[model samples]
Target: MRPLAILGDNITTDHLSPSNAILASSAAGEYLTKMGVPEEDFNSYATHRGDHLTAQRATFANPKLFNEMVKENGQIKQGSLARIEPEGKVTRMWEAIETYMNRKQPLIVIAGADYGQGSSRDWAAKGVRLAGVEAIVAEGFERIHRTNLVGMGVLPLEFKPGVNRHSLALDGTELFDVVGEIKPGADLALVVTRQNGEKLDVAVTCRLDTADEVHVYQAGGVLQRFAQDFLAQ
Candidate 1:
């Protein structure tokens, strides 16, 4: 998987998918405008989440988003920004996500502590999964959000004790491979291959805590598993 974005600590589901008032310049707001919905009628992202077309655009759309992939004046800049790989082009987060979607690229998000801490918003996980993010490696994760990710078929891996994004010195420019089988609390290896032909393996723990969780992930998510079960009967 390719590094799609690098985030700092205490990133809430609100940050992943904001529920605040939609601004005219935001992706969701613009789409509403094109569809003839008046600017004032464009509700908060939380209200429109059932509509994937609009919700997907709001993933990581928080106004306070601080993607380390974006830098300014030789320092990491804050905001909804992303640096696309191979070309190393820095662009707006939504634009980069659109580019990756066009290329069918699978993405991995690297993050610091409390990776998903906030209100238990299912759309938070759904939005990223729709954005082509296949996995997330972080120092820690909220119990609810971790389950939410598994329910959405996104693998959640935790860094070994005391290890974090900073310890790895990741610049969000590496190709990552999650090697090994899926098992609750299993020791998985995250192999990072640098752009200059260097490699390192960091141990990560699979965050699936039970057999049911594993089954849900294997079936592609909670909804998919339920659908299959319903069909089987």
Candidate 2:
């Protein structure tokens, strides 16, 4: 892949996607706290995203609520690296996604094993796709998340065993090239090229393991494919 953006090693899908409990808290805690979501019944972050008031708050508020290995004001950094509006608010991954979405910038996520391993929810892929992620690359994958990605029409790629982001220094800016038609178990080439002109060529497997998957991805998503078929009849 030419112009491939690289990312660091050991990123899981959960790290890429927020958990329901955390998502619930992140979704509602901000505004609700001010309007009084009642700390007791504030609910999980995943539960209240349907409510814009809660979702907006949770989106930004969450970067301050979780432990992302770095702490400020007693809150760990959780979201993406954001320039945080107002000149200085907490910056986190979710907030970064929120910012990128607002800017209409296309995104790509890179990670390592058990990627997308925890849950089987379609929201995991939908959330990222909605946030404008065009594709994802990882060292390995969890079965369900891999399918969910294809179902959402997001590309899921697995790096060959011996090569990963660590060796490539992928950090979300390197562009990737997935050359050749993607097919199940086919060895696809991922050419990672840094902005400064350094490059690393690696081989990865196409996560879409079936003919049906290729069809689904080509059609945009499972639901879209289904709708198209339904309309055809």
Candidate 3:
């Protein structure tokens, strides 16, 4: 898997799925306009989130997002922006997701401490899973959001203490592979292959935390697990 977006500490659910007004030029706004919704009728993202089409566009849609891969003159460019690897094309976050979806690419997010902070938003986890994010490796995670991610079937891996994206010098330019049997609190290897053909294996702790969470994840999420249990009864 490749890094879809490299982020820092304190990334909140609001940043993952902004509740603020959607601008006319944003991916969600343009989609609404195409569906013939009047510009004035384009409601806040929180209101339209029942529709996955609109809500998915809100993934990483926060205007204050500072995606580390999106840089200008050595400074991180702030906005809902992302860089498409190999091609290195910078585009709106939703558009990048569209491109990856079109390519059928599996993605991963590399982040720092306190990932998924703030009010618990289900869509924050749902959106990334729908975007084909298979795993997230972070320095740490907020308790509730970590559970949310597991419920959504997105693997949450925590970095060993004192080790992080910065220490590894991950610039969202490398390919990553998670190697090891996954279980609650299991230590796994994150194999990072660099552009120069160099490889590094870093240790990460799987954050499933409970046997039930492992079962839910293995079933492809909470809802799927529930359906399976009901059918087997």
Give the range where candidate 1 is weakest over 10 consecutive residues by summed lDDT.
72-81
Candidate 2 segments exceeding 4 Å error: 1-28, 31-41, 49-90
Rank order by TM-score, top first? Answer: 3, 1, 2
lDDT of 2: 0.61
Residue 90, model 1: Cα distance from true site in angstroms: 1.3
Which ten-residue region of model 2 has the weakest summed lDDT? Answer: 60-69
Query: lDDT tens string, model 3, 112-142?
Result: 8999999999999999999999999999999
Among the numbered candidates, top lDDT falls to 3
CA RMSD, predictions in order: 1.1, 5.5, 0.7
User: Relative to the unseen true structure, what is the Cα RMSD of model 1?
Assistant: 1.1
Leading candidate by TM-score: 3
Off by over 4 Å in 3: none
Better of 1 and 2 by lDDT: 1
What is the C-alpha lDDT profile of model 1 across 55-127, one tens digit per residue?
Answer: 9888988878889888889788877789999899998788999999999999999998998897999889999
Q: In candidate 1, which residue pairs clash?
A: none
Q: Regarding lDDT, does 1 or 3 come out ahead?
A: 3
